[model samples]
Target: MAKRLSLLLLRVSLGGLLLVWGVNKVVNIDHSMAIAENFYFGLLAAETWLPVAGVVQMAVGLLIIAGFARRWVYPIQLLLNGVSLAAVIASVIDPWGWFLEGTNALFYPSLIIFAGSLVVMAFADQDQLALDARKAPAPVSWKARRDCGQ
Candidate 1:
């Protein structure tokens, strides 16, 4: 029970952080685009596409938190964080010869969260807390059913 509680706490904290970050991107899309522009290039430049990125983040965060779509949301979150970490590394290198950008050290926290996600994926036994708890049904057995007359 205590272990389950710890897992629940981790899931809620991680999920909440993602939801907040996703919402921040959505609410301040211009800022999001600016950051994206600084970190990325080419096809990611379109202004309209920028907001869509935020929307996707928001949706994925919600799904992960709700435990409604782990199989999909978990992998997507992994890929998202992995790509973001790569972007941070690129910025740190400044390969184009421009001055290196100040590291926000965001990647470390994200990597930690990514590790947490892996934990949840590996041992969560399902979603996390109330969401999965509520979804579970009582086990059925022939003896119980026979005693209760079905």
Candidate 2:
């Protein structure tokens, strides 16, 4: 179905994005530290936060790609994306300069990812091509439910 295909594409693409971003944070801690310094990530030192946050980001991406734990994974991913988006959006003192300057690349891309995160959360159930689907049990009859308790 077109719906399934679309959801699949979104899921996979977002997963890849998260994975890469996470790895980038880990690999380039100095860069992440610099960004964090101004982006409300000042609570913790970059050396302590970036790698740990990177691991969480990588895990969220892996779970989204795996598609086996939508009930929990999707929400966590949404929270992560929402926080990141808010930070980036708030950091831009000059909104109109998003495209005019080289320093503001993340402004729009992060917006795109934030929107994608919402879309992914909204249609997480349509992911038929996921691990959860293959592992799910068959639907039970009403009679079975009644017999169990109703």
Candidate 3:
């Protein structure tokens, strides 16, 4: 019971963050574009990538929070978090002094949260409160009737 609750909480927290971040990216396209220009797209100026990332984040957030299609969603979410964590970690550890001051401190908490959420999802029931939570078909053996000592 407690475990389920904790997993649910983790899902909500991470999902909410992703949803907000995605929407923010969409709503504030200028800011997103600037970030992309400076941070993401210096090498590859594929205009579609930013919007695609927003859509993916929003979809992942909704799927994870609603607990729908978790078999695929959970792994995708894990990968997304890992990538974000890696980027932040890399920026923090850059010896070239390109990283902003105190950014590492800010990212440390997010990294911890991401790792914790990954652990929770890894062991979560995945079906709780999800659309996928349906009764599975009974076994064929259960359909057979037996005669008792007739």
The TM-score obtained by model 3 is 0.70
Backbone collision tally, model 3: 0
* Candidate 1 residue spans exceeding 4 A from truth: 90-106, 126-150
Best by lDDT: 2
Query: On residues 67-110, what C-alpha lDDT tens digit does candidate 1 reach at each position?
Result: 66676677877777666667677443554435765655445465
* Predicted structure with the largest TM-score when compared to the true one: 2
Candidates by lDDT, descending order: 2, 1, 3
> Tens digits of per-residue lDDT for model 3 on 1-27?
776677777777777778876786667
Model 2 alpha-carbon miss at residue 111, Å: 2.4
Question: Which residue pairs of candidate 2 clash?
Answer: none
Q: Is candidate 2 or candidate 3 better by TM-score?
A: 2
Error (Å) of candidate 3 at residue 114 is 2.6
Model 2 regions lying over 4 Å from their true place: 90-95, 98-106, 134-150
lDDT: the better of candidates 1 and 3 = 1
